[model samples]
Target: MTMVSDLFNSREIALGVWLMIAIIAVLFGKSTRSGFGGVLKALFVWNLMSWLAGMAVYISAFIYLFYRIGLWTPDLLKDTVFYILFSATVSMFKANKISEDKHFFLEMLKDNLKAGILLEFLIGQYTFDLWVELLIVPAAVLLAGMQAFAANDAKYAAVNKLINSIWFISGGFVIYHVVDSVIQHFHELLSLGVLRQILLVPNLTLVFIPFLYVLSLRMVYEEQFIMLSFKLRDKKLLRFSKRQAILKFNTDLRGLKRWVNRWNLSHPQTREEILVTIDAFKTQQYLEKAPPVVLPQQGWSPYVAKDWLPDEKLKPAFYDPAYEEKWSARSGNLKLDKDWSGNGITYSVTGTRLAADHLELRLAAYESKKLDELHAIFKERVALLYKNATGVEAPLKLTNAISRKKNIHFRQGIYFISLEKSIWGNITEGYDLIFTISTKND
Candidate 1:
């Protein structure tokens, strides 16, 4: 009981409170995922040891520098150390890109120097009250959240400008405060005025660490998003469902665009290159999966005339292979005169060999009251053939035609279909459809 009581006593309670506050700041500022569950995952599932080691290195370096500069009293040193630890903890979460690289210790040392940790430590010397130091995390979080919110939408553009102004003014203030504090603390022993002038540019440059940290987070998120997209693309392609694959690609691409748009609004320097990369990926995927130009030769024909009609009711020309062979041999434009007639309807068929492994066929129906019936039958047959060839449902639908264009255009696997209606002079004449299918390229 005594041991347990000792753990929860005054100093321990204060330490626990500071730890809780530090965790909250990390949850808001550094976590890439969302929600309380996401926090748990980030805390427990991620590389916790790496994060701790990185934070420890950064805090130790800052403390050593501050100690060398005589910036800490023995009593004040404990609080200063805690405050530095809190700041470093919030900044260090998910900093694996720098901290876990090859030359990890050297990289961490470089990061501490490059990220203005010493300047922040100097500022902390003057702002050592626990309450004042506590406010720093909340202030940083608010500013970061506001900046992110502003980036997310144009409606918050005014807010974004205001935030930029705040960052500028706050950076200037930080520089002034550090310069003045140094002058006040070491006036007798050093030419602090000359030192201040010498340090001005570097201090000004480093004061924008908050903004830089946000940008770093965005870069990390972009890398993770890209890797995930590649995995998703591979997984969806392996499933071999054209409709699902295209749908999922479009959905994910839209999300990526929105994310990039926010990032572009926040940081426009890389917008053009980023958009170019995205467009290139889109074009590459489209070209890789695009339907073949030539139609497949297997299980394909322009025999809607013969197949749809009962054999007993068919004309003799329907039974002749030479009839189709003659049309197949003729490469130029189709002629209406070379057509088959049956049951008050006329069918004109044309076949063109586009490649060794593929064929293109056109089937036209004329003087037929059963145009709708013929179209439905033909569409069903084509769809079934497509399903058998691709092992997936045909992504085909009836679309409205415009200005003599095809009413339906669909592609699945290596097959393409263009189904259209031929209209003329207030007469519902017929249907003209083209089919192209090609064997999978080796």
Candidate 2:
């Protein structure tokens, strides 16, 4: 019969056209660049989804047209474009849209819901393929949920974990039961009038779920993204606090010469001020050597703070003048008294072992407010280098600066160039130096 031949011819043309399109896509979709792999992969997924959807939409439309007209003949271009539009509509529904984006999609969801419902109403329509469109929202939600979990921290983590867990558990059991037991009950109900039963309340309910679920998840995901951003900002301030303290200590130290020159040590309040400054600048308190607060009942981790320190005192360095005196006094030999640096600028921390225990230090004199700062800057840079250096191949040279906003400082009145014979032993006197370099006016 003519109807049968026409059906066969139409199907052949559709198949041949699809094959040709596939060849064209394969040729154009590939790339020559190395970094284009991700682009190609995304394109591949998009096209593959479009291709499958196109074929289904065209075939279903053709069959319905044939039954109505008693013959089949599909225009390749017309059918392909229509199917592609339908596929795009399906893809758009589940795409996660931000608040700024939702205005565009609000109209799209309305259009698709109309098309989906109307397609099922046609008597010979083979549009269970339209139900595939329903999958987009749920898939997007599941994906958005996963992204939320991957990057989650304190606050939103609890809710994100709960939704994903509960959804998986509930959906798995519910969907499986619907397929196994409810399918039979629905089948019996639908046997009377399959088309009407399929298109009505159940399908609307099913379609609505995926749509609402994705939209709700996207909203929560957006809110949490904002909260996480704020938390990271707070964490940034916490980290900056340590760096700020170091900079402040360095700045005050650079002012040493000014303070040393101006200090009225003969004043009535001199001793009391010196005592307070010394206590504040003590090595055990200044450095992390101060015992962390510990809960003895629950032993140690990194969090112990404000722990009590015992026997706080300074230890001698390799070149200490005290050792020369102690050695000379022991034997009946000629002893040389080494002269001290200007204004007693010494600082030394005493500990039996390198780390994993208490640290203590003594400064030359914590008398002048300006001079006391030298002890801080010297200890900060010196102690850091010492702790981190393990048997160095070469001697470590560390620089510390005391900064003034608009000026460079050398703490001592003069930069004494000539002293000891060797460069290592040169520069016996300490001096102030500015750390930061600024502009012309600066």
Report the C-alpha lDDT of model 1 over 1-442, residue by residue, as the tens digit.
4664333333334445677976686678645325666757777754565545644565456446645675433434444444445544554543434312335334444654565755654664444334544565567669999898777676889999999998899878768966787788765336543344234323322432443354344445455455444433454432332233234444343334333333322332233444454554455345324423534543233333223223221211221112322332212332223223321222223332222233333445554553445445445545554454446766625323312236555555555545544444335454456544444321
lDDT string for model 2 (46-92, tens) is 64466446545544564465436543233333433443444434444
Error of 2 at 129 (Å): 20
In terms of lDDT, the poorest run of 10 residues in model 1 is 312-321
Candidate 2 runs further than 4 Å off: 1-20, 27-94, 98-212, 219-231, 235-442
Q: How accurate is candidate 1 locally (lDDT)?
A: 0.45
Model 1, residue 384: what's the lDDT? 52
TM-score of each: 0.28, 0.21
The residue pairs that clash in candidate 1, if any, are 295-436, 295-437, 296-437, 296-438
Residue 394 displacement (Å), model 1: 40
